[model samples]
Structures are given as C-alpha cells and as structure tokens.
Target: MKFHLTVDNWTVQKTDARAVRFDVFVIEQKIPVELEWDDMDELCIHAVAYNEAGQAIGTGRLLPDGHIGRMAVRSTGRGQGIGAAILQALMAQARQRGDTEVVLNAQTQAEAFYGRYGFSRDGEEYYEAGIAHICMRHVFA
Candidate 1:
C-alpha cells in the first residue's frame, strides 16, 4: 500500500497524529490515557504517516534532545513499511537538526526491528507503562 508522511510540530498536525497514537497506544495497547500524552508533545518534532485515502496510519516524534518516542502504527498498517517510513522521517529530522545520535526506549519485542535500522541496545530492559522496553540508540556515521 502507498502512504505519505508529514513531519511537523504537534500543533500543526495534532488531530491526525493524535488519532493514530490513540488507536495504537491508548486503545490497542491499553496504556493509560494520562500516560499516553505529555507536555513533550508540544515541544517535539512529529512525523505522521497517512494512507493513500488520507487516514493517519502511523506516527512518531523527535525530542529536542534527540530522543525518539511515541512511535506507533495502527494494527491495520503493520508490516506495510509505514512504521519504518515514520521512523526514517523522524531520524532525518533529528539529523537535520544537527543531532549526532538519536535514542528511543523501544518495546523489547521491537528491538530487532530497530536493530535493522542500525539502532543498538544502549541499556538493560526496563518496564515503562507496564511494557518491557530497552534503551536503544542510532549514531549517525
């Protein structure tokens, strides 16, 4: 399936971005509504992927400090490269901002996926929002 991505601040694409995050994180993952959102959103650089039909299917964000978070793709959009596109877009944004490395607390199950993108484990696994996650980083070469 064909999809497009938009990289912008939260305020500019909040509606579409929120919908994708809400469906994946809030609804499917059962994460607490409160924990799913934070002040960081307004301060981070957001990347949202839209289907050919114009529906938001994936999203991610890059913090000012080069931390990547809130990476998500709706169930229907999994395995279609939407997540990779979103991550690549955010990584590009980080590099454009002069960041040498970008970090993320990836769900342990996804460690291999991130690894394929040149991300390596940075620390021991830990639980966040009740899910097992491990710190990972990709340093631009």
Candidate 2:
C-alpha cells in the first residue's frame, strides 16, 4: 500500500487527525469521547497519514514541550509502517524545533513498539482512561 503524510498545526489538519483519533481512540478503544480531545490540539503540531485513496489512515502530534501523543493508525493500515512513519515524522519535528528529548505516555501493550525506536521506560506502569500506560522518553543525540 502507498501513502503520504502531511505535517502542520491543528488548524490545517484537525479534521483528518480527528477522524483517525475518533476511530481508534474513541470508537475502537472505547475511550470516553470527552477524554479523547483537549485544548492542547490547537497549540501542538499534528501529522496525518493518507493512504493511496486519500483516506486518513494514521495521525499523531508533537507538543511544543517535545511531548508526543495521540498516535493512532487505522486497522486496515497497521503493520505497514504507518505508525512508525507517523512517529518518525513527529520526532523529526521535535528535533527541528531544537527539543532535546521527547516524551509520551505509551500504552503498555505497545511499549515494545516504541522501544524499537529508542524510547525507554521512565516510570512504573499506570492507567490512563482505563488502559495501562507508562511514561517513555527518547533523547535526541
């Protein structure tokens, strides 16, 4: 499958990002609708992945403070590097902004996925929106 990515502020890509997040985090994961959104979106940089058909398949964001969150890839797009590409794009954005490190509260089940990209566990596991998560960090070299 072929796809492309777009990086911009929420103002430019909120619709696309919101769709993927709504599907993955809200409907699919059963996370409360209210908990899936926050004021930070407008202030953060967002990235959305579009498949060959132009459907939004994945999305993620990088905050000014170098925190990464809301990473999601649609079910049909998984295992094809969509998630990795979204993550790398956000990390590159952080580096371009001169951030020394990036952090995220990764769902425990996906810890190893982030680990493959050099993110290390920073604290004990905890729960977020009823899902197990842990603090993870990756320092830029």
The number of clashing residue pairs in each candidate reads 0, 0
C-alpha lDDT values of all predictions: 0.93, 0.96
Best by TM-score: 2
Model 1: colliding residue pairs: none
Residue 8, model 2: Cα distance from true site in angstroms? 0.4
lDDT tens readout by residue for model 2, 1-141: 899999999999999999999999999999999999999999999999999999999999999889999999999999999999999999999999899999999999999999999999998999989999999999998
Candidate 2 at 128: error in angstroms? 0.7
List the candidate 1 regions with Cα displacement exceeding 4 Å: none
lDDT by residue for model 1 over 36-84, one digit each (tens)?
A: 9888899999999988999999999999999999999998899999999
C-alpha TM-scores of all predictions: 0.98, 0.99
